[model samples]
Target: MRDLRIGIIGVGVMGADHAERVVRRISGARLVAVSDPDLPRATTLAESLGSSSAPAAGTGDGDAIRVIEDPLALIGNAEVDAVIIASPGFAHAEQLMACLEHGKPVLCEKPLTMDTESSLRVVEAEHKLGRQLIQVGFMRRFDPEYAALKQLLDSGELGRTLLLHNVHRNKTVPESFRSEMIVRDSLVHEVDVARWLFDDEIARITVRAPKPTGLVADGVLDPQLAVFEMASGAIADVEVFVNFQVGYEVRCEAVAEKGSATIGLGVDVLTRRAGHWGGAVPDDYRARFGTAYDIEVQRWVDATARGEIDGPTAWDGYAAAAVCTAGVQSLQEGRPVEVEMARRSEVLG
Candidate 1:
């Protein structure tokens, strides 16, 4: 099989990792082109892939991969069969719309858009296209533990998932990140996970911010709780902490009519000479969900190669956007916010 020519739009942390994987690990996907606002960075990344940078027209020896400043120009490149969007959150909607307009398949990072109105535009464009061409990168569904738990739920072992309790904690975040990014950036995953796991839309959202602990310094919003009411009448609760002062951690438990299934921490315990047992924890999300990321990328490539729409659809993105919007409102108003979701015919069909 001929390798699928892939282009990356961002060369930051996540984007660079993706480019490396496509160049080094993946079988049928080639990192043919890369674009970043930073021209030198894009050129260096293109060179590292054993492909030189191409000019605007992408004309050169086939060995040259184009490094462009404009993301839209990269989208229109004939050599790019599929695009991976790991750009800033604010750029997602515009880039995705361009891809759909060109009828190119896109794998976009999550939240679909940074805000609700932009997210709606993406939804409207997909509906107009009459097919799902965008796959939102909610990699948790690809996670092995989460997938196993979902399988158990599907098998009736967990019977009628009643509630889900999730915890997401990070040791720290840079002070420059907006205070609200804690919701839009960090807790957004929980919002998506709730929808994916329960296969339900959130009906309402409420947030409660308690007094800050000394453990969390003045500038940090250490712990925040988000309450969700699912359309299925199930309840979901998430606790997010940015200053947990420990290794990165994520935990989830599903309560159902029959039994409960939980995600085990990916850690091994050892006995210390001091007479205490300790286990090592993952330091970051990449360590925790690295396999999931690989699965997500490969699935997108495989599905796109077959001209099939797979992975999280645009509807999933819209739904998560709605929930996240409500989450923001809940935090700001200090009251429960109703989540409104538009129905998608593609999702039903």
Candidate 2:
């Protein structure tokens, strides 16, 4: 079989990383085209990958990679068989619709869309197409540690998990990163984790914050607490601290009737110094979850070659947006808010 011809939209941090991965690391796929609002950035990435990279096995060399000025044109490009959307959240809905219209499979980076309604619209469109054509980029599901935890939970070894505790910390944030972004961007991962691990929907949510870290200005909750009540009678509490100033760290612990399991305590080699014993914390998420991203993209490439999606779907994206909607509302109102979501059957049908 010929290598899957992949085009990536958005050459920002995540998009550029994905483009390099496709050209250099991933098998059964080749980077053929890229598009972004910043034409110079996209052109630079395309030229660099096209000129320097060797073709993957089974994919003959000398395929010309181009920079399409429009993301929709990239989606509709004849040589492009699939698309990876690393664009901003606000741009996702339109680009996703274009992919569906062109019958191109997509691996859209998180947020799926900025809000629940647009996300559901994508779901509805794909459902009407009579196939699953979109996969939301929830990379954590592909992480080895998280996958192991999931397998253990599924095995009944954990014996009906009752509580899940997650800690999401970032070293810093851009000035443009607003307070609501803490819920929409960072904590959204925990929301999906809760739904995925428990195999249930979030029933209600409440947001509370302690004193803001002195480093953060007023009105921004540097560290916040979010409580999610799942439909399965389980609870998942997430502590999202964007200005932790230490390093990027994500930890999850599952408490079950029989026992408990914790992961993400830094898997690097431990050190025994003159007086200290410790391990290095990743400076950012890219350092921490690099392997997971590779696996996720490669799996998507493999599945799209077979006319299928191997990971989270558009409904999963919509559900995540639904929960985050309630979360942001709770954060604003300073009260517990019941999650409102349409049944899958209702929306898909």
Candidate 3:
């Protein structure tokens, strides 16, 4: 099996996890290079991946992983057959465009970009290239349960989905977090789910806040609700609570004509003890979607090896960002805002 050399930008939690997954768990790919503004963090991740500090050409005693100073350079590295943009949202658009320029397959984490216009630029770039080279890392679509639900809906046995109820909760947020992140960061997953499940675009968004739990960091909103009107005439609502302090939970229930289906129960392990029934609650996103992440990466690697993108497209990312942008506008303006999405390319269409 020829290895697909993968370079990852941003050695944060998600980036590090991806590197480790590529090195240890996933097949058909190898972590060849990593970059971060914090050089030490990148070096530390490279070392832990059983790779020594060596250039792509310089082989140490083990599989040496190169440390690139600039993410743009990482994209152009001769050894990097693919790029994974785990960097911040502000950096995503440029790096994605770089991938298109370098003609490398890229797996970009969400937001694609901070706003609709930036995401559209990537869409335009991919369309101009006339190939599918970018796959947005919307991991839930790979989850077994989520996949089952989607298959159920596609089977048409449940009839047309009329409503989708989603819940996303976290134990807490960092001090740097802001109220708008409730829509930008957390509920954005639901935005993608709405698109993936309903196979339509978001037409409208309405945001509501019902007081903060105060358990979260100061100046950050604890909980928020955003309702969506899908272009397919289906509706979806997401409840995002980041300071519930219990555990991380992501769930969705779709109500259709014949019946309903639900996923994301905190059922890692269900037990009966102390005269009570109990189940384990995931501590964070990693615990909640661990399996999904593995499957997502594996599928991406396999598809990239086949010269194809197997997950969410650049268009999916752009539409999700458009919906999230409208969600933020609704949050600020205290009213429903229509999503501003324009398909500028037939490839994306």
Candidate 4:
């Protein structure tokens, strides 16, 4: 099998994990180089991947990965056949454009960008490139349970899809995290999942803010509800609370004419003592979705090696961004905001 040379543009938590998977877990792809603003961190990660310090002619050496300050430089490097954009959301547009310009396939993290207009620009660029070169990192779509649920829905076992309900809760996020609202940070996943499950664009969105739970009074944002109307007339409700004390839990259910199917939360049992049954809850996003992330990266690597864009496309990213933008509006207005989706171009397909 020909190895696909890939380079990651960020060395942060998620970026580092992608590097690890590329080197250790994935067989179709090899970590050719890694670049971050912090050269020291990049070099350390490269060394840990069993690469050398001296950069090779085409690909970097075994002990060292090419550490560069400019992410665009990584995209243009001869060694990097594909690029993974795990940098900050704000930097995604520029990095993605560079990759597409170089005709390298790219797997970018979710939201695509902070706003819809920027996301549209990405879509436009991919359209101009005349091929599908961008895959947005919506990992939940690759989750086993979620995939099962989608199959069930598609099989018509649940009868007419009338309503969908989801709960996304985080133990807590920092106070400074409010820079991005619940729509961008917490509810964005729900937005993506709901759309993917229903295979429809959200037509309307409304946010209902309930009273804050006592457990999170330190300006902690908890329990935000978003109601969505799908283009197919399906109604979906999502409750996102970042300060839910129980554990990092994600729950979803689809209500249909005959019956409903739901996803289980947490592990079966963590401990049985004192006449009590307990199950461990994940501490953060990374833990809860660790398996999903692994599957996502592997799929991306495999698909890229096959010269195929297998995951979420640029259209999905733009649609999510549009819905999220409307979600922010609905939260501000405290009313249902109608979302208008642009026509999908052939390039996006």
- Best candidate according to TM-score: 2
Error of 2 at 167 (Å): 0.3
**Per-candidate TM-score against the hidden true structure:** 0.91, 0.97, 0.94, 0.91
Q: In candidate 3, how many clashes are counted?
A: 0
Against the true structure, candidate 1 has what lDDT? 0.82
> How many backbone clashes does every candidate have?
0, 0, 0, 8
Among residues 3 or more apart in sequence or in different chains, the pairs in candidate 3 whose N, CA or C atoms overlap within 3 Å are: none
Q: After superposition, which runs of candidate 2 have C-alpha atoms over 4 Å from their true positions?
A: 57-62
lDDT for each residue of candidate 1 in 228-322, tens digit (9 for 90 to 100): 99877999999988777787899999999988878956555665777776777777788788889988888888898898866888778888888
Which model scores highest in lDDT?
A: 2
User: On lDDT, who's better, 1 or 3?
Assistant: 3
lDDT of 2 at 279: 88
Per-candidate RMSD, Å: 4.0, 1.4, 3.0, 3.4
* C-alpha local distance difference test of each model: 0.82, 0.90, 0.86, 0.82
lDDT per residue for candidate 2 within 169-240, as digits (tens), equals: 999998678789999999999998999999999999999888888888778977999999998788999999
lDDT of 3: 0.86
Report the C-alpha lDDT of model 3 over 1-349, residue by residue, as the tens digit. 6678899999899998888777777777778899999999999878867554432322222587889999999999898999888998889988998999999999999879999889888898898887899999899999889999999999999998999999999887776778887788788899999999998888999998887785766666668988999888889999999887888888999999999999987666889989999888878998778899999988998998888989999989988888888888898888999888885455455
Residue-level lDDT of model 4, residues 255-281, one tens digit each, is 998899898466655788899988788
Output the TM-score of candidate 1.
0.91
**3 against 4, candidate with superior TM-score:** 3
